[model samples]
Target: MKDLVIVFPGQGSQFAGMGKQWFDGNRVVRDRFGQASDLVGYSLADLCFTAPPAEVTRTRFAQVSLLVLSYAMYEVMTEDRKIPVSAMTGHSLGEITALLAAGALTFEDAVRLVKARGEAMESCVAESGTGMVAAVRMPVADVEKCVEEFNSGGHDVQVANYNAEAQTVLSGTLDDLKGLTAHLEDRGAKVVKLNVAGAFHSSFMADAVPAYTEALHEVEFTEPTVPVYSNVTGEAHESPQSIRESLAVQLTSPVRWSAIVASLVERKAAVWVEVGPKQVLKKMLTGAVGSGEVHSFDEEPERVRAVLDQLVELKKREPGLVGLCLGAAAATRNRNFDTAAYDQGVVLPYRKLQELSKLDQETLSDEQKQTALDLLLTIMRTKQVPEAEQRDRVESILRRTGDAGLRTIAGALAT
Candidate 1:
């Protein structure tokens, strides 16, 4: 494995005795947890390690508790161990742990960010806003279309969490969520109402972002010693300034985990790690790399006596191993190569091409592939499409592999 990407879980993953086993034996882990408690002033250890279930279950306890354990586990693993940590990323609430682990923010800074985030999340939920529910076994476009249909019918709903293929969560006002849930269930999704207070990661969170942004300005984020892949674009952020802004927007923005996974896999990452009590992040990562190996924070104590056990074992078996890599876009900018826009508003299983490239090889069958190549030429040659339409058409091309079984679709690429 070249680089290690450790993922962390968010609010719902917390429990009263999350890291007790490790904390009992590890002086370093205890010390770090105490450090977080001192910064928060009220004794996070009391709330995390020893609080009653009811208290620990509060939003106040839930968010902070999760962060403390995740950060401490990370410290125990990396402080004296030889973990092959080349890069890292975290989910919604876990982003703080990632920032701290990547050296972009101090432990104190991350805890404070968590304090504000928990408060913000709580406040947003307190409103008469609707709830959130995960809808599984449905296509992305179908899920999106379902949200659209609900809204068009006067329910203010949108897809909030895009967890993985066939799994997504939606959010809106209570009525909106309820109505959409019914519609989505009718459309064949295994729906589960999440145990979340408010609808997060949707427009419903817009009101909370400004306050969070202002909070960000009060703190200073360092240029990360490691690049932390952001959920905003599913790519590594450029600087502290960019990351600060991104953190604020993250509450309201859709988590592009699929894109993040695509970027990591496209780069052929060595291994991915999940640094939380449960394997929630591991599940998300499995979607990205079905056959890949992943190291996580929830292993047994004796099993993980070393933080980088998997790394040592991996390297011993295969030293100097490198993965097959995708070539970069030809230096000549292909402004027309993006396949995202074309993917929008269209059915998933019905993917079609919108760009022109790679019709020469055996990646595609001869008949359908040639038609796609021709479609690309039509748009580029005619320039007849509205600029927006042309852009969509171009992306549509690249997103589709092997063409859509249409001679018209394939042949249009050569235009």
Candidate 2:
């Protein structure tokens, strides 16, 4: 669970009725959609469930709808279980959803920021004739060279998305893209014009940056509870200030998606959950990371239930402080062979921890949890376990359970 990385999708993955199942099955999800509708000044539920494909696909409508749906899926998935997320990230518009998942932004604020962002991008498109195209089965280097050739010839085209090693997205003027499309096909790469509104992640969207940045400034960005990768930097955002700056410039910045995947792989992320409306990110992971347990929560009901059930089983199997204390008591060799001290320290606290572990974890108050942790540490200390090792074990438990209340106690112990 410490290796779990949850991802969200962005635009182009949306479709009519994308989140219908969750909307119908969960009242909280329904409420979230309602809240989003109010914030965006439109019936998002209607747009997602009953609107025509053309209407739902518009950038202004698609961005917020996908955000709400993705965030709702995330909420439903984690409501009853704790997912020890190692990190979270998203494609272009999905980065906003990632922030929401990581607790950096409230749903209301995310909705407003995304709404303004979508509107700003759409406005930029209206002012200029620009679009995007996907170049597949081509090396990123070759694709960049093609883009460079076009740019050197006075075209504004740029490689806007390094989606994968073999898939890249280019954005520029329609005429220039048309010419580039023919050139790419001639080079043996399949080029499909993307159904997008503007030359996103290119200088063509520069005007939108100021507007999006203005909206960004109005919202408060707190430190993420878990790491959230940035599309602009292809790395984990370091701080709230960094997030603010990265997001402001994201409009005209290429989505370094391949770089993000490489970073996750470097971190040895072993389990990936795409908690969004489509399997786009899941497919991307298969080609990028190459090996991992990948699940698309939105693809099927059974898949979603399977992941939730697995988390529940994992939580039950986590022995918490009891396992730590008992293992240390049994494993650490007796130094002084002080039997009475061992009985008073190790045996007594180990029994107490066993009893505490039997209680419903949710029913345990913060004081009780802290007391149990303290008992485990004392037993480890009595058994002559290294202080650093004890801290490591405690931190491992914290990572697996992601218990914020326990984190407070762990932080105090660290000091």
The model with the greatest TM-score is: 2
- Candidate 1 shows a clash count of 29
Judge candidate 2 against the unseen true structure and give its global Cα lDDT, from 0 to 1: 0.83
Local accuracy of candidate 2 as per-residue lDDT tens digits, 1-415: 4377889999999998888889999987999998888877889888988889898898899999999999998889888767667788999999999999999989999999999999999998995888999999999999999888877888778889999999999998899999999988999999999888889998898888888989999999987877789999999886889999999999999999999989888877777889888799988888567677788988864776676577667766766544544565566555546899889888898788888878877677767767777887767767777768777676555445454325444454554
Report model 1's TM-score to 2 decimal places: 0.73
For all candidates, what are the clash counts?
29, 0
lDDT score of model 1? 0.66
RMSD of each: 13.7, 5.2
Q: What is the TM-score of each candidate against the true structure?
A: 0.73, 0.80
lDDT of 1 at 357: 35
Residue 230 in candidate 1 has what lDDT? 89
Task: List model 1 lDDT by residue over 108-142, tens digit each.
Answer: 77788788777777777776566788888898889
Q: What is the C-alpha lDDT of each candidate?
A: 0.66, 0.83
